[model samples]
Each structure stands twice: as C-alpha cells, then as structure tokens.
Target: MPKKERKRLQVVISDEQDALLTRTAYELSSPERLISKSEVVRLAIEKIARELGEGEHLEEYRAILETEEVGEEEA
Candidate 1:
C-alpha cells in the first residue's frame, strides 16, 4: 500500500468566504481539491504586478516621444 501524505498547517476562513469557495469549487468540478484564499490573493498580486510593469514600459515610451518632440522643436 502507498503511504499517505502528511498534512501541513491548517487555515481558518469566514463562513461567507467558505461558502463562496465551496460554490466555486463545485462549479469548477474541483470539489475534492483544496484551494487557498492566500493563493488566490497571491495570484491577483502577480497579475497586478505584470500590468504595472506593462504600464511602466508605456510611460518610458511616452517619455522618449516627448524628448524627441522637444529635440525636433529646437532644430
């Protein structure tokens, strides 16, 4: 027989959040899987970081265009 995996730490959630999680899990057909609110929050942070990085690149491009326009006016 295969050995069972050891359990890790436990986390508590509010009743409302627990109900939402259960509904989401069932709707997604992942009822047996364990999902963490922390994991969801972490993923949201990562997505926001990626969007901010893209926005920074756009700002850099805008700065370059403004500098080019200033140089053209001086010529």
Candidate 2:
C-alpha cells in the first residue's frame, strides 16, 4: 500500500502583507499554482543557511544589498 500524506496547517498573515502576497500570487500566475508563503519563507531560510555556511565571506550578501540600494535609487 502507498504511504498516506500528512495534513496541512493553516497560517495567518497581516492584512497589508496578505494583500501584497495575493498581488504577487496573481502576477506569478495563480495563487493555487504558486507555492505557499510558508514554503517560500522556508526556501529563504535555506538560502541564508547556505550563505552563512561560507564563513568569513560576506561579499555575496554585500553585493545583493548594493544591488537593491541601486535599484531603489533608480526608482
């Protein structure tokens, strides 16, 4: 017999963040098609873990921040 799937849990978001999430979901296709916000947050945590694992090297993070700043300035 096949293994049974686990049940899903519910999460609550603030009204402002919820609106942004919905807008993002629509832009990325449909909310149903996109992964859950929890999953997205988990992936972000994994990325941070990988970055920190590279000890004494923060250049990557610095570059990312610089790029964001530049984009904001342009905007």
In terms of TM-score, which candidate is strongest? 2
Task: Give the per-residue lDDT of model 1 (tens digit) for 1-75.
Answer: 999985555655557767776665455455586656555545545876787687756576678769867866796
Candidate 1 runs further than 4 Å off:
1-29, 56-75
Local distance difference test, candidate 1: 0.64
Cα deviation in Å at residue 72, candidate 1? 48
Taking all chains together, each candidate's TM-score versus the true structure is 0.34, 0.40
What tens-digit string does per-residue lDDT give for candidate 2 at 2-73?
Answer: 999856767554577677766654565565577665555556558787778876347877897798678667
Model 2 residue 8 CA deviation in Å: 19
The stretch of ten residues in a row with the least summed lDDT in candidate 1 is 35-44
* Candidate lDDT values, in order: 0.64, 0.67
Candidate 2 lowest-lDDT run of ten: 23-32
Q: Evaluated with lDDT, which candidate comes out highest?
A: 2
Q: What is the lDDT of residue 75 in candidate 2?
A: 59
Model 1 earns a TM-score of: 0.34
